[model samples]
Target chain A: MEWLLEANTAGHKFALMAIAILLFAVVMGGILFAVDRPKRVPTWVVVAGFLGPTLLLLVVGLVYPALSTIRGSFYDKTGDEFIGLDNYARIFTDDGFQRVLLNTALWVVLVPLVTTALGLVYAYLVDRTRFESLAKALVFLPMAISMVGAGVIWRFVYEFRPDQPGVNQIGLLNQLLVLVGIEPQQFLLTAPANTLYLIVVMIWIQAGFAMTVLSAAIKAIPDDVVEAARLDGVGGFQMFRYVTVPSIRPALVVVLTTIAIVTLKVFDVVRTMTGGNFGTSVVANEFYTQAFRQFNFGLGAALAVLLFVLVVPIIAYNVRQLRLSEEIR
Target chain B: MTTTTPVMAPVPGEADTRGRVHSRAERAQKRLTSRTASVAAIVIAVLWTVPTFGLLLTSFRPELDIRRSGWWSMFTDPQFTVDNYNQVLYGGGTDFATLFVNSLVITLPSVVIPITLALLAAYAFAWIPFKGRSVLFVAVFALQIVPLQVTLIPLLSLYVDSGLAGSFWTVWLSHSMFALPLAIFLLHNFMREIPPSLVEAARMDGAGHVKIFFQVLLPLLTPAIAAFGVFQFLWVWNDLLVSLTFASSPDTVPLTVRLADMVGSRGSDWYLLAAGAFVAMVVPLIVFVALQRFFVRGLLAGSVKG
Candidate 1:
């Protein structure tokens, strides 16, 4: 058991993985077998067989921990003493945390709107182009890689070196500046601007997702509606404005709110690129920093609750939009 | 086929007789061939790809050259080497090869477990005439909004108390737990799409719930399964927060954690970071390209439906 738990070698890790999968299979197989017997089993037994493990895991993992974290938010650093809203007050009052809140606001607002807009334009442009699939795939490729990988790629692009006579700029952005006879700037060091630079990486990663979803929605626009608009001398921008936009409004809402939810919880891009430094720390990254690095669990729990609170309104709006779209359909 | 020439011409009324013949085709062609839109698309595609392409090019360049000059300079100097990749994979202090294997081990089970559990649960929610099924399904669906951050600290303490802290088991279990709500929600949507008469016919054949699920629904649900499977695979493999929290040890830490550490500790080593980033990206890129259709389908189903 100890060996399994502390497995380092390839052989042991594979062995452990195999054991875990096998164990899951056996337990699930047993439950299903019991439910599939010759005698008729009650619907409750069948339902329990299907849902029992999931409910157990969810209750143990998500429900309990969520409630505990909410409780922890009201406690002190050690979580032994109750402090009662002091942590939340500090988040709203402290200058450093205020910057964190401002940065998060910038991220949630800018990332979704820019990503969705770029995706919409790109999707419309390439809707029925000769190389539509290939073009869309090129943009969407970033969605496959981890945000950390995307961060590394963009970090290299934004890499900075001293503006010296002997030194040549390696970062593509810096090199471009040098080519145009401009001084190479520190893309990730400068405050406020650095946050936008980091936000670009997210926009890059999420634009593909937005494009894919919006492209499908564009395709689903009824053919007759487009034809009728075209027959009315509606072409170019006007057709897109009058015909296409209204047709995919539901999809537009989904794309916007989905990206917003994801942007609100973004940690990897900020963590990897800036380590939440230079006023680039969003709520998600700050939560990890406080809990893990700073070991201020109470503050971290407050931030986590804050994130949950922030997400609820976006989710509520999303659900409302979804309900509206379903009714229309 | 006969209207292909008219479709190519920009002049609209010259081919009025042929226009009505393949107007849909002509309209599609005109919509796509707008000169401004084409240029815009080409520009956006290049902007989207060039950053990653630059890094990919750097990963194959010699270490000194990569640090001293831009990857675009390689066109003139034209030096290339695999030493960066070799060092990142097996060199001292940074053995990403091991982390690669750890990612695989962690990802497979994390994906498999949630998907298997979600499938059964979705089946029950869709088929089993249980009391309060709709209420329970809606509850699970709503659980998707619970940010994993809210649950991380308590869950971490729980793992420590259970003596499972810093193990792969903890990472796997945490990922599975975080994934369940979305997985069950998406899969339930897909399950409900299958016709009820299919299940009824199976039941009429004296097949029990398990048998019906396996013999009837399982086969029909393959596309849905693949869609969600691709999603879960990508999510688990690409995850950083859960793995960082649970698997802090050397043995259990996956590639993202290791790469993030390398970036922190060795911020200047472009060679290792470039090679390491690509190494982490390779599997997902392949999966994304190979199974892109299903992945897109899954994305549409999960988001647009809800």
Candidate 2:
């Protein structure tokens, strides 16, 4: 930033960036308009028009930050040195980074699985119930909550006061446990378990999404097939196992893998709940810590890239599932 | 498709021998699969609901009682008063009612402006054929992945330069940018399902784009509009980040950030925080319940075959 400012004799902090962007948008819009004229536009013009905005956004928003991050990761904590993959190497060997990865992996696996299974069960049970709306609303309430709001609410749920330690725990969970003759447990700020606790919030918010999508898919299942399965003596658990599960398989895959990809980028809950302490750090949280807290943009960038690398395959798989569903239709 | 009469009960051994041990075990099993589920659902519902319930209770209770003990302990040390609500409404200070009005002012236009713009953009992406449409659409969709934190600094810089940083419009524009991709994606998916044949038929009648959009399409889009309205309303209503960035001034500040300050800065005053949060939540809750019917797959009645 210092070099760019020094070298460019424009002497205008905002003008250069703003004018460049506005001019680019205007030119691209004009090109798109002109090139789209029916058969008069040269093929080259059409190609340029089609690719311009995408190319501009990719370069400015994505590639620039990405390249900067890569360069920064090679540098020291202040992003001054050219340490050459020291951060990358550290990610594998460093205990902290490894813990972050393991916690993220646990999240990437557990939250999606639990949410989808719970959601599917709820959807199936409430399929044609009289109180279906009310039941669904109860579960869906969490979805309506902002992550910040939910975090704040849950903080009160897990609130601890050491000074008044035995003065009847105020946290709802501990209060209940105590009522049942169990000792109050510190749920947050506990190693490994805090990660799971964070995952629970994600699951709560995301399960409604899974349920909605899967319910739509379940409703789309052919009535004839369900009737046939019924006639074949499919009953109770067997019905869900053999008939309903297979029928909503696409929706399940979409929900699970979509969640997996999202969990890979989980940031807000961990940020709000534990501030990435107590071994609750994931790659995303680590990235934020490095970039914002520690000012190690390079390491943060590497962590972000690692996050993207992990997510890309899951995203591809999800997109492929969507395409397959489209093809089936 | 076989028309076999599949038994609703378990096929012999699988009949939830656990839940079925009781009378009407089949119905009980149908009620809840595992004892864990029943217990879990009840526990979660109660636990999850308590904080909000506390907020509600505190809204109605006196400030003194709220600060005295835990809200649940209200059962033991019962002290009831409507002083919180009184202060919220008619207190000599900045009451929540004034903040609620400010919230409405902040929320409504923020919701309306972006949704309207996104709808037009979504239509063009979904249906209009100027050229470069799919590529343009994909570019917009990809914007969904760009985290707002990265953009905020640049956007704030831009806002400062443009003399819009402290204005309400700044927050609106921020929400628009944050919301545009997802809104476009959702609306595009919906508009695509409106059967091109119907659109083509309208086109054959020599209807221009505006006419076609208004006469033939807008009515059909009511449910989508309603759903999107609810979504946008909820988002803008609940938004703190944007309000914090653009509208931190006393006159311009929306309720969420105000509520945050009230909770965090005002000596952890549960009475004030709860009352303030309740003020913020009521509108969104109303919007959620009222237009919730549009949330169903009903509008796709003739659009798709299952």
Candidate 3:
């Protein structure tokens, strides 16, 4: 058992993986075997066999912890003293935290809108073109890599070498500046601007998602509608504006709200690229910093609650849009 | 390309109408093939790829060369080596190979456990005659909005009390827990799409719910399973926050956590960082390319139809 927990050797890792899978198989197989036999088994027994593990795990893991964290938001840093609303108040009033809120707002507003716009245009341009699949794949490749990996790649792109003789700039952006005889700047060190740079990495990732979804929606448009629009002499920008845009309105809404929800909870890009320094910390990263690093569990819980609150309206709008789209379908 | 070109000539009857149609087709083709549109498409693709290509180029350069010059310089002064990858994977201080194994270990159980559990639960919700099924399913679906951040601290303390704090078990359990809501929702959606008459025919044959699920529904649900499987695989393998929170021991940290630590501890080591980043990315890239059809199907099903 101890080796199962602490082992690092290849043999031990594989052994533990096997043990874990075998344990799950035994437990699940036992439950199924018990339920498989015994003709005319009661409804209660069947329900228990099916929903028992899932309900228990969800209750223990998600429901209980979420409720406890919300409760903890009212307490002090140590979580021992009950200080009502102080943590939430500090989030609203503190200067540094104000910047966090502002940055979070910027990220939520900018990333989704920009990514969706780019995705729509790119999807429209590349639709039915030669090499459409390959072109889309190039954009979508970023989505496959982890955010931390994307962060590393972009961090190198944003790397700032000193401006001096014989010190050729290594980062692509800075190198371009040097080639054009302009001074190379610190891309990740400048406040606010650094936030935009980090947001660019996210846009790079999510634009693929937006494009894929919108392209499907674009293809789903009825052929007769397009043919009629063409007969009516609508083409070029007008066709995209009138025919394609309205046809994919539901998908557009879904992409926008989904990306907004994701952006609100983004942590890795900020953590990896800048470690949330230089006024670049959003609510999610700040929550981790407060809760885990700073050990301010109360404040962390507050930030988490804040993120939840912010996500609610976006989700509500998404659900409404989905319902509308389903009705149309 | 042939499809887009207006190859037909104007007909004798209704010559003006035919000309109008031909001109529309020609204009559409021109719009598509216009230099500006082609240039814009190529520019976007190049911009999106160049950053990653630069890092990939640096990954093969010698450490000294990477630090002293731009990756683009290699085109003129072409030099390359695999030493950076060698050091990043097996060097003295950074044991990323072990972390790579840990990532695999953490990801497999995480993907498998939730998927298995969610399948059973989805079947119950979709097929089994049970009370409160709709309410329970809705509650589970709604739980997707509860960001994992809200649950991290209490869950961490729970793991601490159980003495599973730094084990792979904690990471597996957390990921499984976090994934269940979405998995159940997605799987349940897929399960409902299965025709009721098939389930009824199985029921008519005196088959039990368990038998019908295995024989009838599971086979039909393969595509959905593949879709969600790819999703959960990527989610768990690429996760950093949950792994960082639970798997703190050097033995248990996954590749993303180790890579993040390297960035924090040694921010300037471009050669090693570049190679390490690629090492983290390679599995997912391969999986994405190979399973791309199912991956996109899963994405569209999960998000577009949610």
Candidate 4:
């Protein structure tokens, strides 16, 4: 039991893991065995065997903690004293916090629009072309990489070295700048633009997701509708505008809203690339920093709640759109 | 195939040939549109690929070579070694080998437990005549929208109070709890699509709910299970926030948390960072590339249903 709580070595850790899995298996197996007697067992007993763990976990894990966090947001830093709305006030009034909000605003606005636009255009281009799957896979590969990996990858690309004799540029972007006879700049150190730079990593990772969904949506457009548009002389960009865009409007909305929600919660890239320095922090990263790093529990909880508040409308609108689309179906 | 076709011979009652000619014309138009689109697509592909390619190539380059030159310089002066990988994996200070194992240990249970729990719950929601089934199901589904951030503070406190703050148990339990809503919703959707007759038929044969679940449903649910399994596998493997918050001790911290810490502490040590990034990424990339079909299905289902 003590070793289960504290595994100090590799052997101990693996042993603990095995024990945990076996325990889960035994519990679940016992439940099934107890309930496998058909009419001998009551329906409520059967239901409890299946649903009890999940329901109990949800109530204890998600529901209670979420309520506690919301409550914690109103208290003082140590979370013992009730300091009504001070954390929220500081979040709204503090200049640094405002930058976080502004950066979050930028992320919520730009990442989705740019990523969706890139994805939609890319999906449209390779919709039926030769080498389409391979090309799309190339764009979609980034989605598979963790954001921390992406952050490291981009950090390498943005690595800075001062310009001097015999000290060549190490970062590709800087080298490109040097090749074109321009001084290399600190891409991650500069304000405002640095946030955009961090946002690029996100867009890079998410474009694949956007493209996959939108490409499927484009394929789902009825061939008859396309043929009708072609018969009506809609060609080239006009076909894209009037026929393609309108046809996949539902998917486009879904892609945009999904990416926006994901972007709102993005933490790793900023945390990895800059550690939320240079005014690059969004609400998610700020929440982590406040809670864990600075031990400002109340402010962190407030930021977390702020994130929850921000996500609701987007999700609500997404559900509404999905419902509308389903109703149409 | 196109070269063998006659271009302008519209013979009588040869609708097939006419269709071929029409398609050829469409292909011609498509070729025209594809020209510009191809260029844009190529540019995007290059932009998306080069950063990752640069880091991967650098991971093979010697540490000094990496520090001194861009990876693109490899074309003119190709210097490579496996030392960076060696150092990152087994080097005394930056050993990723332990973290890699930690990632595997944390991820497998995290993925398996939630899917199993969600599977049973989804089965109940789909088949069992339980009171408040719809209400409870919707409540679980709605829990998906409650950001994991909201649960972090008090959950951490809960773990601290439970004497499990810095163990693998904390990470695994947190991940499984967070994954349930979406897993149950996704699995329930999958279960509902299993014709009700299948379960009813099993019941008529004197099979219990558990028997129907195992003998009838589990086989059909494999693909759904695989979809969510791959998804959760990749997610838990790549996660940083949960592992960082719960697994405060070195013994329990997974690769993402360690990798993120490396990026913070050794920001300039591209030698270590490059190899470490790959160490963290390789498992998910393999899972993703191998089970891409299931992964895409899961993604589409999540996006559409949500």
Q: List the global CA lDDT of all models.
A: 0.89, 0.64, 0.89, 0.88
What local lDDT score does residue A256 receive in model 1, on the 0 to 100 scale?
Answer: 94
TM-score for candidate 3, residues paired by index: 0.96
Task: Tell me the DockQ of each model, to 2 decimals.
Answer: 0.53, 0.11, 0.55, 0.50
- Model 3, A1-329: lDDT tens digits are 68878877878987898899899989988898788753678877887898899999999999999999999999999899999999999999999999999999999999999999999989888876666877888988998999999999999888998998988889999988888989999999999799999999999989989998998888788878987897787667788998999999999999999999999999999999999999899999999999999999999999999998999999999988888778887
Write one digit per residue (lDDT tens) for candidate 4, span B1-306: 111111223244333443534557765786688688789889998998889998999999999998788888889999889999999999987778988888888999999999999999999999998789888888888888899899999998898898888888889899999999999988988888899888889889999889899999999989899999999998898888998899858788888888888888898999999999998899999888888888888888878666
Off by over 4 Å in 1: B1-33
- DockQ, candidate 3, comes to 0.55
lDDT of 1 at A300: 98
> Candidate order by DockQ, highest to lowest?
3, 1, 4, 2
Identify the runs in model 4 with alpha carbons over 4 angstroms from their true place: B1-32
TM-score of candidate 1 versus the correct structure, residues matched by position:
0.96
Q: Which segments of candidate 3 are over 4 A away from where they belong?
A: B1-33
Give the C-alpha miss distance for residue A28 in model 2, angstroms. Answer: 18
The local distance difference test score of model 3 is: 0.89
Residue-level lDDT of model 2, residues A129-172, one tens digit each, is 44455566667666665555565566566655443543656566
| CAPRI classification of candidate 4 | medium
Candidate 2 lDDT, B87-181, residue by residue in tens: 76657554666566556665665566556656656666666675667777776776565544444434555677877666555665566556666
Each model's backbone clash number: 0, 6, 0, 0
TM-scores, each model vs. reference:
0.96, 0.74, 0.96, 0.95
